[model samples]
Target: MKKIIAYNMLMVALFTPICCAQDIARIVEDVGKSVVVVIGFNVDSTANKLGSGCFINNKGVILTNAHVIDSCLSLQIELTDTIIEVAANSNGLFCTTRKTIKIYLTKCS
Candidate 1:
């Protein structure tokens, strides 16, 4: 009985990390799909600031620091293959220049 218990414990210790590793990999892949690059530009088309953010929901809402989009006349959100441009309005609402696209999150190296 003692030998069997020791073997089982050893097996679990080795397999636990493997299972955890697989879970971590899947999570990274899933989150990577939502990562975005935020670029703020001035009225003259010069880049003002660059930051990173992720989509918090499916409704095209992004969660980022206020300083990322501060004092910019327009903003650009870069996804895997899409670039979304929006002008800064008085109400802080954004109007996309193109059709709506899905957002994904990612982990940056």
Candidate 2:
């Protein structure tokens, strides 16, 4: 009886990580709709940088790395779900004017 209990515990411990990974993956899938690909453009309408960001609210607010938009004259944010459905690269999205957008840093103090 002791050996059987130990064997069962070992199996449970070994499978715990796999189960946790699945749960994490499911969470990501659900949250992926709120994720976007942030693209920066120069004054000449050329690509400057690319990075990922997450929308914090339904008002189109995005949080991303500072370097992602460095030296950029314009920005474009494409929803991951839309990108997946379009099957196109970052160029598929339209650029948004700077006046109509806002970005915030999420760094820990």
Top TM-score hit: 1
TM per candidate: 0.78, 0.59
Worst 10 residues of 1 by lDDT: 100-109
RMSD of each: 5.8, 8.0
**C-alpha lDDT values of all predictions:** 0.76, 0.65
Which regions of candidate 2 fall more than 4 Å away from where they truly are?
A: 83-109
Error of 2 at 21 (Å): 2.1
Question: Model 1: what TM-score?
Answer: 0.78
lDDT by residue (tens digit), candidate 1, 5-47: 9999999999999999999999998998788899989879899
> Candidate 1, clashing residue pairs?
31-105, 31-106, 32-106, 33-104, 33-105, 34-104, 34-105, 35-104, 35-105, 35-106
Which residue pairs collide, candidate 2?
none
TM-score between candidate 2 and the true structure: 0.59
Where is model 1 more than 4 Å wrong at Cα?
89-92, 102-109
